[model samples]
Target: MKVNPTTLSWQAPTTNVDGSLIDYELEYEVGIAGDSTEGDYAPLATIPGQLRERETYVAPIADLPLDHGEHTIALRSFDKAQPDRMSEWSEPVTFMLATVPERPLELRVT
Candidate 1:
């Protein structure tokens, strides 16, 4: 997974078995694990479309509050042909939103 100023995107996993492509689903979570509540994450978003061979899937930037701490993000892929079947969740990625100092110090010269 990769994160920019406002977007977090990744490549959709390819189907291993023979099956028709249907759509893609993206899910994410923010905040420290175990200490965070369910509301801290965004609901899963579904994109309806067929996946081209060797094509990459990308999702739009999800709006989230910038808090100072380590945040976790996760994603998974689902097959439309088999709605019940889903790929294993990818490795969780961590990002930190640092807090900026309120005041800047001035330097004095003799």
Candidate 2:
């Protein structure tokens, strides 16, 4: 069985709500659902925080279940200094997976 995984990426928040630079490591919580809006989301992944010069974050959904025709993915981040506090879920990204058509059985020369 072949699978087509989706690569999701986002940049971390560089400043706090007060405009102060974020000096702590940040973790992320990812969720997935079958609707474009409104519904409970299933927990997808909890990415550990990493200190990096670039604040960009990338996550690949390799084992994403494709039972539904459409799917929505979302995620939030929190500073490791306070795990209990987390930012609201980012805007959901809706997408669908498509498979290539089967090859033709036969071909004839013109």
lDDT of all predictions: 0.50, 0.71
For model 1, give the 10-residue run with minimal summed lDDT: 26-35
| TM-score of every prediction relative to native | 0.45, 0.67
Residue pairs in candidate 1 whose N, alpha carbon or C atoms collide under 3 angstroms: none
Off by over 4 Å in 2: 1-5, 34-42, 51-55, 63-68, 98-110
Candidate 1 on 1-110: residue-level lDDT in tens?
23343555566544444675534542222223344563243434454433323465444434454455666756655556665665555666676666556686786788
lDDT of 2 at 2: 24
Those runs of model 1 whose alpha carbons end farther than 4 Å from true positions after fitting are 1-4, 17-54, 63-69, 97-110
Clashes of each: 0, 0
lDDT of 2 by residue, 37-94 (tens): 4755677778766623365666666544445355677888887779887877888887
